[model samples]
Target: MTCREASEYLQELMDTTLAPDLERRLRAHLDTCSACAGELTLQREIRRRVAAGVPRQEVPSALRQKVREILAPREKWAWGFLPRPVIRWGMAVAALVLISLIPLTLLQQNREERIASIVIEAVNDHRSFAMRVNLPTLPTADREQVRELVEAKVGFQIVPPMGQRGELRLVGGDVTYFLDRKVACILYGKGSKLVTLLVLRDEGIEATEQGFRQVNGLRVYTATYKGTGVVLWKQDNLLYSLVSELPQEELLGVAKEMAKI
Candidate 1:
């Protein structure tokens, strides 16, 4: 391969995603191409620095306490002696209040923990899908369909990365169950770069004004998937997130697209 080709392939090589033959060719080109070698060295250094600088912080005790309070039942009354109508009305009101508070409580507890769980699941999904990258039997469209299938099967949606329609294309997606939650991951590729979007079940998120937050050193901006932004609220027992690595503007656009879906 030419020097430019090899240089472009270096990103995949760093991620260990390139085919063996192509990787060898790229390495040979790098051996003789000073510019490419220098570029790879710089990329490696940046990756190393990023890895060394970002340490995972533990969830704060205050947050944990708050979460417990939110998730913990406020009052438990024995209803065995109550009349049917009285018990039904009381139970319904209690359920409504509990449903309303759970998401708020979870948010108060630790948003970072929620985000970390999702990110880890996404990374695992990416690793699994990478195995099919070079499989001749897997068509590109089929890869994308596979991801969508997993999302459907797992009862979640996958947000395609930005610029996918015109520039980057859907590569694949995977479903992973982690922390007793289901996460759907959709992978997109632009040239040689790949980005994955992870969506966790929305049973635990609270309904509140949309906002932005960062976790695990990654910037996480939240908004509703279709309308204004995601309502940090809970429904049933799931927490929902429409997440992506696409820039904020593009992610917002994609969220709008998701609303249509």
Candidate 2:
């Protein structure tokens, strides 16, 4: 191949195996052209750095299915103008080019974005309740009354810490939508900082598992999503998620206290 032709196919040459004749000509040009060889070295180094710095993230199932659908062969394609082998080869090359361009960071971002959406939903719900014009919903500090109201809507009772007098007091109770299902929220505030204790039936919410800890005989799972601290535990077939911007220690303390109830 001439120097210009070799340069055009350099990336493809580096990426995959080429036809024997094409590979032979490219190597012949490289042997005579020092500049092209140096350019090839630089491209390899850049690719190496990109591969080393970014860890591979698994493709999401939905994206994998979509890719499969796109690559699936049709019954009688218009590309029949080309031989079957040629069509297959062209499709493979196109698929490889498309796949190579997808960065690992993109997959990681998809997962983080999903979790962030949940966090945003929680934050918005809290802000809406805090900024309400009036108490349009039930406002009660009574544990039994709040539990009955929340359980009636969510099928999960809000269990407060074992004492009537505690640092976190239940100011009110309300219902909110989380993952298309009703979530029972019990509002509590120590001072200016508000805490939303969300109780619901676990339906496999996607959360990165932090560390599991035993607190007050309950296996508590701790995780942070989008800078928001989250502590979840299960009891009586229901899941309790304590979400707030509070420090991890403070949040864990609240979760432990609730677990004691």
Residue 122 miss distance in model 2 (angstroms):
2.5
| TM-score per candidate, chains pooled | 0.36, 0.47
How high is the lDDT of residue 2 in model 2? 72
TM-score, candidate 1, is: 0.36
lDDT of 1 by residue, 218-252 (tens): 33345432222221222234343444434556555
Residue ranges of candidate 1 with Cα displaced over 4 Å: 1-108, 119-139, 156-165, 207-210, 213-261
Deviation of model 1 at 47, angstroms: 35
Candidate 2 clashes between residue pairs 3 or more apart in a chain or in different chains: none
RMSD of 2: 22.6
- Candidate 2, which segments miss by more than 4 Å at Cα? 1-117, 132-136, 161-165, 205-228
TM-score of 2: 0.47
